[model samples]
Target: MQLLLAHVTGIQLSVRGVWELLRTHGWSCRQPARRAIERSEAAVAGWIKETWPSAKPLPRRSGPGSSSRTRPLSR
Candidate 1:
């Protein structure tokens, strides 16, 4: 945001200056409420238990096929 301010207004501000500006506008920082009031914890846990395995990354292969090279290995 400070970078944006400097980019748009040709003014650079220290971190404290940004905080002061936010406070002047009545913006106080607090932990975001990540969970909805109507969300069910049991439902969330059940979904994770039942569905998360499919969403996880594929198991990585090793040995000859697992080389991180983009092109064919040189002869």
Candidate 2:
């Protein structure tokens, strides 16, 4: 992507060259979410529900105020 743009614009850069540039500039690729080894799925869900707008994001015009979204529990 960026390498393509650079090459077309006469910058002359390869994928490896871009990688080297990033490394030299002390930049790193994005990383995944870091979770504890002893993560509790139920606890995480509970936390999300309790802390997320208090719940999930409800669709628009679902009958409610804008304070937060009330998510219906799925069976």
Q: What are the C-alpha RMSDs, in order, of all predicted structures?
A: 5.8, 12.8
Which residue pairs show backbone clashes in model 1? none
* Clashing residue pairs, backbone N/CA/C < 3 A, model 2: none
Runs of candidate 2 with Cα error greater than 4 angstroms are: 3-9, 32-75
lDDT of each: 0.88, 0.75
Question: Which lDDT value does model 2 have at 35?
Answer: 77
lDDT accuracy of residue 54 in candidate 2 = 46
Which lDDT tens digits does candidate 2 get at residues 10-68? 78677888788778988889785797899999998888778887466687765544544
Model 2 lDDT on a 0 to 1 scale: 0.75
List, residue by residue over 20-75, the lDDT tens digit for candidate 1: 99999988898766867999999999999999988999998664652666877553
- Listed per model in order, the count of residue pairs whose N, CA or C atoms clash below 3 Å is 0, 0
